[model samples]
Structure formats: C-alpha cells, structure tokens
Target: MDRSRVTVVIVVLAAALALPFYAGPFWMGLATQIIIFGLLALSVDLLLGHTGLFSLCHASFFAVAAYTTAILQVRYGTPTVFAAPAGVLAGTLLALVFGIAVRTRGVYFILITIALGFIVWGVAYRWSSFTGGDNGVTNVPFPSIGPLAVTSHLQYYYLVLAIVMLCALGYRMLVSSPFGLGLRGIKASESRMRSLGYRTALHLYVAFVLSGALASLAGVLYVYYNRFVNPVTGSFQISVEVALMAIVGGSGTIIGPFIGSGVLLGLRNWVSSFFELHAAVMGVVFIATVLWAPDGLVGLARRLRKRRTGIRKDPA
Candidate 1:
C-alpha cells in the first residue's frame, strides 16, 4: 500500500477502536451492523468487481448459513464451536450447487441467480415447519467458546472488529495472489483468457463459491449480533442492497465495500427517523452515483486528488 493509504487505514482503525468511548450504544450497534454488512458487500464484489459476474443469489448462501447456525444453537443446544463451522459448511455447499449459474453470462446469469435466490426465500417463507417461516429463528445466543464468551454488544463489537481486520488482511493477500490476477484477466476478457489456455468457467465457479463462503461468514456474524434470523435475512432485496454498497463504495478496492455500507446504513438510520420514504432516498443516491460517480466514492476521491495535484503543478 502507498504511504497515504497506510496512514488512512491507521487513522480509521484508531477511530473504530475509540468509537465506544464517544459513541452511545445505538451508534456502536450501527457501526457493528455496518461492518457485518460490509463483509457481505465485499463478498459480492468478489464476483461483481473482480470476476465480472453479477450474482443475485448470494443471500441464499448467507441465509442458509444463518439458519443453520441458529437452528443448531437454539433448537439442538449446539456449541458455538460446532455450530459456527457447520453454518459455514452448509452455506458453502449451497454455493457449490448454485455455482452452476456460471454457465451463463450477462443478463442470463443475473436472471438465473435471481431465480435461485427466490427459491431460497420461498423456502424460508413457506416452509414454516422447518424454517419457522416468516417469523424466522429467534433467541440466538452470543458466540462463545469454552470460557471466552461474548457477553455484551461492546465485547461483540470489538470481536467483530478484530475478525474483520483479519479478513481484510487476508482478502488483500488473496487479491494480490496469482489466482486473483487470473480472475481479473477473466473479467477483462474471458475469450482472451481462454485463448491463453485458462479454464475460465472453472475459475469463475471457484470464485462464486468463495464469494458465497464469505457471505456465509458474514451471515454468521450477523445472526450472533442481531440475536435473530428472519426470512428477510435471505430476501432478494438484501442481495441488491449489498451489490449497491459495492458499487457505491468502489467495487474493486478492499475498503470500498465497508465505506459504502457505512454510507448506506448510516443514511438509512438517520433518514428513516423522520422520513417514511427512506428507500426512495437510497434510490436517488444510487442514481446519483451512477450518473456522476460511475467508479464510486473511492474513484471520486482519487479523481479529486489528481485534479488538486494537477492544479498545483500547472504552469499557467
């Protein structure tokens, strides 16, 4: 990373660590939600930003993992150790099956994913016997392992921060690795990548599964934090919203998704207080982003910085 970027990261981390000291419980909780959903947006970007696939079914994997963890923990009294991994496993396996959508491209791929996402949502909504239907599973306990139990929201916030930091670091390494390069190449031109003897479809499939696994992890974090899982958790709107977060924050960069999440979620929280049309506000924000900031907030910042530098160096 550049020196400026490193400095920004450090400042951001320091602020996050100090948030509890100045922010109230509501703000702290909102921060925690932003991080969790940011993880989800990051997962979506693995396909949308890097692999050039627009998937709408990621909520299936996320919801499935959440339900699995919730079911195991609440109904069967499973420990966090077993339940958490099982949740990830279930969601990943679903991703493996849904990865078949990679066979199609463009709008077809989007349509297929939408169909798959609806299937999961339908099951979650109608299958009241197993899934608790629209009510979803509730009374989920905080994650605990042996004696290291998360007892409060503050503790959970710190725990989430620690895990997200590790995830961001690992994600950076993954994107810089050779496989990451291959995905980017595939995104630029799949035909050219194939001409170069790359198994593009298999690569995309793997990316899809990996993305789903990340989304599943986010879901696990969410269920523990929210202490409930509802049908809305697996809804199509979530998939759409997270995708917007990726685009609005800067799709390809690691930090963009989180920034987008903060903007969207924070805006919603603040706007909904007095306005009943908060969703419309989000739509307007998205339209503004598309029309004026196609490359997103991060890109906009870079452009402004370059312009400032240019003015400083201008001979005229």
Candidate 2:
C-alpha cells in the first residue's frame, strides 16, 4: 500500500479501537451494525465492483446462515463451535447453487438473483413450521466457544472489530493477488479474458461463492448481536441497501463499504428520529451521489488531493 493509504488505515483503526471508550451504548451498537453491513457490502462488491456482476440474491445466503444458526442454537441447543460453522457451510452451499446465475449476464443475471432472493424470503415468511415464519427465531444467546464467551455488547464489539480486521487483511491480500487482477480484467472485458484462455464463468462462480460466504459470516455476527433473526434479515431491501452502500462509499476499495455503511446507518438513525420519510432522504442521497459524485466519497477525496498536489507543483 502507499504511505498515505497506510497512514489513513492506521488513523481509522485507532479511532475504531478508541470508540468504545468515548461512545455510548447506542452509538457502539450502531457502529457494530455498520461494520456488519459493511462486510455484507464488501461481499457484494466482490461481484458488483470487481467481477461486474450485480447480484440481488446475496440475502438468501445471509438469511440462510442466520436461520440455520438461530434454529440450531434455539431449538436444538447446538454449540457455537458447530452452529457457526454450520451456518457458514449452509450459506456457501446455497451460494454454490445460486452461482449458476452467472451463466447469464446483465439484467438477466439481476433478475435471476432477485428471483432466488424472493424464494428464500417467501419460504422464510410462509414456512412457519421450521423458520418461525415472519416472527423469526429469537432469544439467541451471545456466541460462546468453550470458556471464551461474549458476555457484554462491549466485549462483542471488540470481538467483531478483531474479526472484521482479520477479514479486511485477508481481503486485501486476496484482492492484491493474481486472482483479483483476473477478476478486474474480466470486469473490463470478459470476452478478451475468455479469449486469453481464462474460464471466466468458473472464475465468477468461485467469486460468487466466496462473496456469499463473507455475507454469511456477516449474518452470523448480526444475529448474535441483534439477538434475533427475522425474515427482514433476508429481505430484498437489504440487498439493495448494501449495494447502495458500496456505490456510495466507493466500490472496489477495502474501506469504502464500511464508510458507506456508516453514512447510511448514521443518517437513518438521525433522520428517523423526527422524520417519517427517512427512506426518501436515503433516495435523495443516492440520487445526489449518482449525479454529482459518480465515483463516490473516496474517489472524490482522491480527486481533491490530486488537484491540491497539482496546484502545489505548478510553476505559475
């Protein structure tokens, strides 16, 4: 990474670490939610930003993982060690199935994902016997493995922060590797990539699965933090919201999703307090982003920095 980027990362990490000391419980909770949703947005960007796929069914994987974990723990009394992994596994397997949509492109791919997502939402809403219908699974205990247990929200926040950091580090390596470059190439020109002997379809399929797995991890963390799982957890709106977060925060960058999440969630929290039309406010924000800041907040910052540097170097 460049020195400036590294410095920015350090400052962000320091702020995150110090948040608990200064922020109240409500703010901490909001921060946790932002991180979780940011992770989800990151997963979506794996396809939308890098692979040029816009999938709307990611909530299926996320909801499935959450439902599996909630059901196992609440009804069957499964251990965290087993339930968590099972949740991830279930979501990955679903991703494997949903990845077939990669066979199509453009609007068809988007429609297929939307259909898949609705199927999950329908089942979650109607299958009251197994999924608890619209009520969803509740009273989920904080995650515990052996003697290590999260006893408080503060502790859980730290745990989440640590896990997200590791995920970001791993994601950085993955994006910097050749595979990441290949995905970007495919995004630019799939036909050219295919002509170069790359099995572009298989490449996208793998990325889809990996993205689903990441979203599943986010869902698991969310269920534990929220202490409940509902059909809304797997709603189509969530997929849309996260997609917007990616675009608004600057897609294809590691921190963009998180920044977008913070902006959206924080805005919602603040706006919803007195306004009943907070959703409209979000719409305006998105429209403004598309119209004025097409490349998003990060890109805008970079452009401003470049302009300043150019001015400083000008002889005139």
- TM-score on alpha carbons, each prediction: 0.98, 0.98
Note the residue pairs that clash in candidate 1: none
Cα shift from native, residue 168, model 1 (Å): 0.9
Q: Give the lowest summed-lDDT range of ten residues in model 2.
A: 168-177
Per-candidate Cα RMSD to the true structure, in Å, reads 0.9, 1.0
Off by over 4 Å in 2: none
Predicted candidate 2 versus true structure: per-residue lDDT over 1-316, tens digit per residue: 8999899899999999999999999999999999999999999989998998999988888899999999999999999999999998999999998889999999999999999999999999999999999889999999999999989999999999999999988888888898989999999999999999999999999999999999999988888999899999999989888988988899899999999999899999999999999989988987898899878899999999999999999999
Which candidate number has the best lDDT? Answer: 1
Q: Candidate 2: lDDT over CA atoms?
A: 0.92
Candidate 1: C-alpha lDDT: 0.94
Q: List per-prediction Cα lDDT, in the order shown.
A: 0.94, 0.92
lDDT of 2 at 223: 85
Q: What is the lDDT of residue 194 in candidate 1?
A: 99
Query: In model 1, what is the error at residue 3, expressed in angstroms?
Result: 1.1
